[model samples]
Target chain A: MKKQIITEGKIYFPLSETLKLVIENIMKRLTRALLTMSGIVLSIAFYTTLMLTASALKYTLGAQQVISEYYWWMLFLAFLVSATGITNSVLMAVAERVREIGTLKCLGAMDKHILEMFILENAFIGAIGGVVGFIVGIIAAIVLNASTIGISSFFAIPGIEFLKALLSSILISTVLSVVMSSYPAYRAAKLQPAEALRSVA
Target chain B: MGGEASYAYTVEVEGLKKYYKMGNTIVKALDGINMKIYRGEYLSIMGPSGSGKTTLFNMIGGLDRPTAGKVFIDEVDIAQLDAYELAWLRARKIGYIFQTFNLIPVMTAYENVVLPMIFAGVEAEERRRRALELLDRVGLLKFKDHKPYELSGGQQQRVAIARALANNPAIVLADEPTGNLDLETGMEIIKLLKELNEEREVTIITATHDIKMLAVSDRIAWLRDGKIQRIEKRSEVRFKVYKVEG
Candidate 1:
């Protein structure tokens, strides 16, 4: 027998269930997911390459060097472009899934759950892009500086400093992706179920 | 009307109105409509494209707010509930089926069936058991792992029907459930819904353009120009099919 209808309290999916959905969604659209992650990957790789090259140079020369401001400005521009790309990609994704979102709403999903799903999806992409970009940057730095710094110098950089750079790159990419995805996520969550259902494609 | 205090009506709509403004003119989608639906009844709302069947369907499902008036589901005014409470109501009491068979494209048939139960916070074990049972009932247990795109239109609709019954809702709202199906498939869906309605004793309300639904519906409400033109019981209504001779 069906239970009596009661209107009280909020409905929330368990985190494990939500994570599974996020993973499944990403996996199903692997091509689009990879396309969206490309912006993060390229930008993070560039940023990491610049930072690692500078660290390698400083370590090889045994000098405390001050990086130029123009480099910082260029890095900022790269991130700006990457953020724009991610935001545009995520917005399109939300628009494409308007009907899906409506179906979810009809099945009793709250705005918060929708928000969490999108955020987690982008965060997962960000993490993957961050790690991949960091590895690429590490390889690029080694190839570029190996001949001049005698290969040993590249590895001679302090372990703590190398770990710090990796952590920072990952943190930056993840934060950038999340921040960029917020507006699209918010728009998706605030969609009225009725209008969303009526939307075409 | 007797003075008995029995709450036989499962849904009630009072003085409902919905208006949309298109530039200088106003379109009254639903105008001063009122209705009462009994528990365990099969009711069909039939209308043309612009007759506001979808609008009234949305209002009753709590998917859209009315311009005025009240919608009482199980004697509670839906507009009075907050967002969280409304979600709870939708999750626990109402099941909706759409013409397009809006199962999650990324999920398999089994996952789609289990989704509503997840929102209703059913235990993992119970959800799995019920999902498999519902799949078996729908005669799609073998195709449980197929995604929406992999299934045929009829198969997808069956999956959607099973998903709708996941949480054991008291009311199932179907909007053009057979709009995308052929005559044979549409009949199969209608029969399945009829059987489920009788077996589960759930209130089934459908907004459709299909005249075939009249055979299964206990009561049929005809809407025209944003208002109920007439409502008739199955016994009182008559049909005539005209065949064209070449």
Candidate 2:
């Protein structure tokens, strides 16, 4: 005896099982998820703050000529470290769930389904971290710039610069997350069901 | 199609061989074995620890490819199919039960039961209905919302059984299904499996060392040293069981 979820000719609130699985998986590892997010957050926050400070100082000190073009190297380094962090963390998560993947395979789940779950999980993590990092980075940039120069000078800085920094940080974190997860996702998809069972047995 | 029209067996294995290469030596897990399992038959494969019973079970379940042989399930030659075709066949035809009760730890019993249905493209309402019925049939309806960690060993195995039956598969392949449970709980599992086999006429093939399973089986296949030692009808299988006093 089960309650009917459909009314009339239409169904009410039909959710795909994959979406539920992805959400449940992420929620189950909230502590590890948060730890993984912190890496992205810290990296993006540093990148934003550095960019904002350079723009603010350019106007305040009228020293645009003194700004080094090699400053982009620091940003590149931050991006590389953050991408590596996401890859390692997602790989560890996949390693712990090898048997679960095998069970899914035995139950008829295709490689694409397993791949989709991992990508979606990392994308969500990246988005949340990016937004939070943007806010924190902007605030830090404003506070430090104000203390270094006068509050009036800080307010004089163009709003466009902050918007650019916001978009950059968010885009970088989200894209990095997806790119970094591909290898581990492929590895998970390629796992043989029998071998996976033995790994945990 | 003409060739398949004459076969009466649901699963037909011919000259199946599986060998694993470890370092420099090749271990013959299943050597030149052949088997035929008919529809609605309860067959048990019994053997000691390294006797290749599991290897045979894997070959029939489409979980592993044999070195030199063919497995035909429901008239389709599985060895001829590619990965995609094999996945489709496995999803639509076979249900697997493992000793470790491989239910997703984060999902509830109900969700675990409906997982295979979801893979088979069953709609939400139908999937829910079937999952509920299977859980109730397996006597795990009361624990539908519980996670695997929250359930007892017997309860978890019951959940796994319910999950196995979710897709209404052509066959259920159980590998040492009672290996991890107590004797009393194992008996309960056997009773449930027996009821399922009789009530639904689902083909049940189990690989195990548990003598209790032999009682309920229609045919028992004994394997030793990578070869089938003997196959006996249930009426011909006679063995003594002695209880150990604690």
Top of the candidates by lDDT:
1
lDDT per residue (tens digit) for residues A10-68 in model 1: 47788899999999999998987898899898888888888887877788786566468
CAPRI grade of model 2: acceptable
**For every candidate, how close is chain A to the native chain A in TM-score?**
0.91, 0.81
TM of chain B, each: 0.95, 0.93
Candidate 1, B132-232: lDDT as tens digits = 99999999999999999999999999999999999888899999999999999999999999999999988999999898898999999988889998899
The TM-score leader among the candidates is 1
- Model 1 DockQ vs. reference: 0.53
What is every candidate's C-alpha DockQ against the true complex, given to 2 decimals? 0.53, 0.31
Give candidate 2's total backbone clashes.
Answer: 0
How well does candidate 1 score on lDDT at residue A129? Answer: 90
In model 2, which runs have C-alpha deviations exceeding 4 angstroms?
A: A1-15, A58-71, A150-160, B1-7, B240-246
